[model samples]
Every structure is written in C-alpha cells, then in structure tokens.
Target: MSILYVDHEINNLNSFKATFRRDAEIYLAESTEEGLKILGENKIDVIFADHQMPDMTGLEFLTLASNQYPSSIRVLLTGNAYTDEFKRAAGKGYFHSYVNKPWDEQQLRKLMISNLR
Candidate 1:
C-alpha cells in the first residue's frame, strides 16, 4: 500500500517516515504544495495531513485531495483536540480518520491496514 503524509514540521515528517517506512511505500512532504505534487504523481492508498499548515490547513488539502482521489483514504492529524473543522470534514466524507498528535504506532499501523482492506 502507498501512504502519503504531509506535515509542515520537518521533524515530524522525519519521525513519521522513520516509524512507518517499512510498512509500505511512503511519501513525505513538508507542505501542502509538495503533498499535492506527490498525490499527482502517485496512486496513493492512504493520506495523512497535519491539521495546521502554512499554505492551507490540512482540512483544505485533504478535502481537495478527496475530491480528486476519491478512492484514497484520507486522515487528518492534529496536536489540538477535535474541533468544528473535523466534525465538518468527517460529516462531509472528506476525512476517513482523525488522529491526535503523538500517535501510537501500532494503532496507526492497524488503522492504515484496515482502511486499505
């Protein structure tokens, strides 16, 4: 399976990649623009985007990506608690999952594989 993860924090990007690289084909990006480019060039099975980003919030990017790649599962990650934005995204079917920051690797891995299945 292919996983696309976008985070504005370079350290988070690196850490995520390090944790999950062995699981599948992993694509990492430090911005929404780079994430979009990766999505364009790849047939991603899953996507993870940070809630707060520079160019646009993860909500915006994932919503757009969901429109363009309906088959891919989209997940939003955030350091803050769930808010109205998440409720809207999930209600609209733009988000398949919402994960809090400092995610548990085992749970996340299970989430990814389950989504693929």
Candidate 2:
C-alpha cells in the first residue's frame, strides 16, 4: 500500500520518508496543493499530515482530502495537546486517528498495517 505524508517542513517529510521508506510506498508533499495533486495522481491507502502547517491546519487539509478521497484513511499529527474541538472533529469523521508529534513508530506501523488489511 501507498501512503502520503504532508508537512511544510521539508526536514519532517524527509525524516518520515527515511523512517518508513522500507515499509511502504511513501509520497511526500510540501504543501497542501501538492498533497492534493499527489492524492489525485496516486492510489494512496493512508495520509498523515502535520497539524501546524504554515498554509493550512491539519484539520482543514484532512477534511478536504477526506471529501475527495473518501476511502483513504487520514491521520493528523500534532505536538499540541488534544483539544475539545479536535475531539469533536474527529468524532465527526474528519480523520481516522490523531497522533502526537514524536509518534511511536511501532504503533504507527501497526496502525497502517491494520488499516491496509
């Protein structure tokens, strides 16, 4: 399965690519527009986005992506503590999961594997 990861910080994208490169086909996007383009061109199974992007909030990006690619699982990664609104949005189906920044690689891998099945 393929996965798409979006982050304005190129370093973050590179790090994720390095970490998961062997596990799956990884596509990295530096902007929301690029992320959308990648999604349009690819058969992505999951999307992981940073919540504090410069151009758009993770929720906004996830919401748009979810609408266009309804079956692709979405995840939001944020350093900030979870808020009530985030909980509400997630409850409403904006994203499948919310992960803290400095994520546990093993857990994420397990989640991805489970979703792929």
The most accurate candidate by TM-score is 1
- TM-score between candidate 2 and the true structure: 0.95
| RMSD (CA, Å), each prediction | 0.9, 0.9
lDDT of 1: 0.92
Q: Please, what are the lDDT tens digits per residue for candidate 2 over residues 10-107?
A: 87888899999998899999988899999999999999999998888988999998889989999999999999989988988889998898888887
The stretch of ten residues in a row with the least summed lDDT in candidate 2 is: 102-111
Badly placed stretches (over 4 Å) of model 2 are none
Error of 2 at 24 (Å): 0.9
Q: What is the C-alpha lDDT profile of model 1 across 42-93, one tens digit per residue?
A: 9999999998999999999999998999999999998998998789879999
Model 2 pairs whose backbones collide: none
